[model samples]
Target chain A: MKKVIVHVTLKEGVLDPQGQTIETSLHSLGFTEVEEVRTGKTIELLLDNHDNVEARVQDMCTKLLANPVIEDYRVNVEEAVQS
Target chain B: MKKVIVHVTLKEGVLDPQGQTIETSLHSLGFTEVEEVRTGKTIELLLDNHDNVEARVQDMCTKLLANPVIEDYRVNVEEAVQS
Candidate 1:
């Protein structure tokens, strides 16, 4: 099986309110060195094959996993070990 | 500045509830080929330098970004293109 990891994040120039909230919360919890924080989403897909998985996963990202206008995605593929 | 992207996901063999939700939602929305889906989190940090950043970021992942036992993380570092 092929395992693909997908990372979905807001474009660098976009603002992230959820990240801001986490930063402030961290500061309150005594983590003072945090300069900035941006939060996103991670997804993993287990497929029987890797061939053409990239295009399908990208389609998944655009169609439902992410808000394409403000967010971007990176996908990494690894071959899963067989038992 | 150093930009680090952290991907946190459920360890292999662990069940993912959120991913199942998304998969079902997608099926309802007309996507039928999706086999399985697993979901996690992504975090981006912009640091002034790379020195000692990995340790700090890993600490951040352990302390705040992810749950140690059930979740695993992989970090990628990239130099931001300065304008």
Candidate 2:
């Protein structure tokens, strides 16, 4: 099985309310210097084949992994080298 | 500026309690079949220079971005091509 990693984040020019919440929460917990924070999502799926991995994963992201209106996604495919 | 993107997730062999919690939360929100919901963090930083970008971001990930005990991280450095 190989691992397909997906990252979903707000596009550069967009505003991130979720990230703002996290930043405030962190500061409340005494992590003040975390000057800026943007929150995003990461997903990992183990698949059996490598053929068309990138295309397939991109489809997944566009369809279910991210909200295209405010977010963008990146995908990385890595082989599971060991057990 | 360069964007240093960090991805932090539970290492493969370890259990993911937080993921489990999110999965349950998803189910409670009426999204059942959303079977393995693993949550991780993604951070974006804007840097003016590209020199030592990888090293600098890795330091950030290790120092504050992720919990090393249960999570592993990956970094991507991308140049901000235009205004």
Docking class of 2: acceptable
Q: What lDDT tens digits, residue by residue, belong to model 1 across residues A1-83?
A: 66778888888789899899878876776656667889988777766654577787777778888888998888887676452
Fraction of native contacts, model 1: 0.62
lDDT tens digits by residue: candidate 2, A18-76: 66775676567554444566778887655555567687667666766678998888888
Pairs that collide in candidate 1 are: none
TM per candidate comes to: 0.76, 0.57
Model 1, B27-74: lDDT tens digits are 787656556888988777766654577887787787887898999999
* Each model's fraction of native contacts: 0.62, 0.31
What is every candidate's C-alpha DockQ against the true complex, given to 2 decimals?
Answer: 0.51, 0.23
Top-scoring candidate (DockQ): 1
Specify the highest-TM-score model's number: 1
Stretches of candidate 1 above 4 Å error? A29-31, A77-83, B29-32, B80-83
Worst 10 residues of 1 chain B by lDDT: B44-53
Off by over 4 Å in 2: A21-35, A80-83, B1-3, B17-39, B47-64, B73-83
